[model samples]
Target: MANAVPVADFLVLPPRLDRTAEMLAESARRRGMAVEHLSSPVVPARLQHSAGGHLYGGPTFAAAVAPDLDLVPLEPADDWLPQLPYEYTHRDIALTTLGEARWSRTPMFVKPPRDKTLPAGVYVDGSRLPGDERYPADTPVLVSEIVTFLVEYRLFVLDGMVHAASRYAVNGRLDPAPLDACAHRAAVLDFAAGLLDACADSLPSAVVVDVGLASNADRGDEHWAVVEANMAWFSTSYAANPDQVLDVVLRAAGPRHRLTLRDQAFTRPPTPFPGTGRSGSSPMS
Candidate 1:
């Protein structure tokens, strides 16, 4: 099966309990397949196969174990969702080193380049970031204009097509009831398709793109916007079909990835960064 790489060919080594990897493993076992879980963080020298897991500690851990294993391609947080050419579903955002944000006393959404321990939130000024001391004072971060998303969906994309999608959140909560997908299937799919086309060259062959309505207003002028892109291996599946999500996961960060994908998902090396409490491994994962 194209999606059925032997469990032995992959490793499960999430920093903690990664429900998505567990679900995939369990589902594979139900189908008479075998998978293994490595309790230790250290990957053996001889190990050279795909692994499925999430960043429990930080990117450094993934970076540490990557060389010894063939885990799904974990793109750098900063590199996964680069600035888009136009304001599709994304708001105005900028990336800069912490030093550059020192004097800025404006309210904005600030977060690490990738998901990390540091919480991403609105800070009145760059100097007020709570956990900035945990990382080097000069760590990089993303500063974006604040925007509200009434509803959000996670789309599993492979080869520029949305294979599976689910309504993951609503009004700042985990209400994975498919409200958005059910009510706006055409709009969501259409918007995702066009946005994928517009940003295809900037994204990985397999990844997760989060999209949401920009406004609660019932007007044709209102359109969906890009929330962000995430590494399939580390991202939650939400209410998306497990089988379809698994297919995407396998293709996104599977054994075949070495030949078909880029060496490093990010343009730069992993730096000391944290995540906003809003993102990372979820209960559904």
Candidate 2:
């Protein structure tokens, strides 16, 4: 048989590749692309030109590999998509950092703006927040009104279009099911389109925008609401079409990416993979 030509390439961490990463590598190989599993968690300089791009675990990994590729590294998820409604006047949703948190009597969903150092959960009142030992007192956080997600979907967006999406959660649980491309999927996509249009200029060229069905008695019915944004490099693919997700992954961290002024401030060391007892770091914080 004639030697196959490569269509794409991958740079993955060895020993433990997440299901999504594994799927991407397998899919790429199936298509005659090359995948290199590295033990050092570093993207070698040689691959910078030969390989399409690298897929990192998180911002830290991306930062580590960036020096090898001589490319601008990625910013934290929070910085990439800062408190949307608060940063952008067009968004009605309320979002603020824990330090500046002013909500009393009302519960809010709080989570670390970038990494999983802090667990994401609903705080009945700001007073109940765990002590600030984990992160600095001034650490940025996402504090938003608790909204119910009847069904949540993760969309892989690229340049104003959603390449692929998957329903990953239902009623705040880990329920992954392929959404029919009919009414249900249409509803989710429609909601996403409206959101993207509303905040067209605010979002990055490539990122993951999560949306969900929420019921507002005052509004009288269930409608779609923003569930916050995640960095495309780190967000789980869930059940999203693997091939489509891989394509987004490639473009999201492709060579065209430029370093932001904030990337220089990203000096924190790499975080360990989740559930790997090898590392003392916490996962899904």
Candidate 3:
């Protein structure tokens, strides 16, 4: 359904991800849908021009604050995630520190949280930071403690259904290979449920579960833990075959619940940036 013609509605990114929203829109139009793309207010450019604007027939389009957008509910029955959203540190520090441990493993995993996904190839460890490039003295870097794991998996859920699943070894060192289709499905289901429970208000119409290698990261290499929750728009199914994932996104408009976008503000207590210090730090501000 998502692919069949933009279906006379406007598609939009909630608080961010303009490029992604555009791509999804393009795919829909190609299938004969006429759609309009709007960036979320997270983008200054979008926010600047958001006020006093309108779009297609579906809903009022605006790059307003996240609270302003009417998102759909993803309420789960109970606690879904085995643990909290994966707490990750900087990749450079994660890699650099883990390297010091001499991991007997091969495929090491590295992920930066959604708030900081940028500058491609910036591994979790400090290894990615250039030796010469002086980071603003005020910038602070967060890195994950090196961890070993066993199985790796990916889950795709659309409109609350387990649409696609895949398993990976992620280069062997991580030992997430020999994908287990069934295990991945269950993991994804659990994750999707957790997302509904944890982020019911922010529950988007769609989402993809990026289950971490289900190995114990704290005990042995076979330990399993939740890695991080990623936005459906930001995640890519390494093995989303049959491509039904696309159609699900389209049909989602059918009886799909829409969360009212509350016009509020994202007031995060000011924190120091990466590198430098408050008393004597460089300035990017």
Question: Which digits, one per residue and each the tens of the lDDT, describe model 1 over residues 142-258?
Answer: 777777787788998887899888988888788885434478788889998888888776777777888987663334245578877876766788778777777776665544344
Give model 1's TM-score versus the native structure.
0.77
Off by over 4 Å in 3: 1-7, 10-32, 35-111, 115-128, 131-142, 157-164, 168-184, 187-205, 216-218, 241-244, 247-285
What ranking of all candidate models by lDDT puts the best one first? 1, 2, 3
In the range 1-285, model 3's lDDT, one tens digit per residue, is 111221233344443334335455566666665453444323233322222211211111221222222222122111223224443211223322223322323333433233232232324444544333343322333234454434456555664555665664453343322234445555546655665466544333454555554444454444235444444433444545424444534433221233223311111222343342321111122
CA lDDT for candidate 2: 0.61
Prediction 2 TM-score vs. true: 0.75
Candidate 1 global lDDT: 0.62
By TM-score, who's the top model here?
1
Ten consecutive residues with minimal summed lDDT in candidate 2?
276-285
Residue 89 alpha-carbon offset, candidate 3, angstroms: 13
lDDT (C-alpha, whole model) for all candidates:
0.62, 0.61, 0.37
What's every prediction's RMSD, in angstroms? Answer: 6.9, 6.9, 11.3
Candidates sorted by TM-score, best first: 1, 2, 3
Structural similarity to truth (TM-score) of each candidate:
0.77, 0.75, 0.44
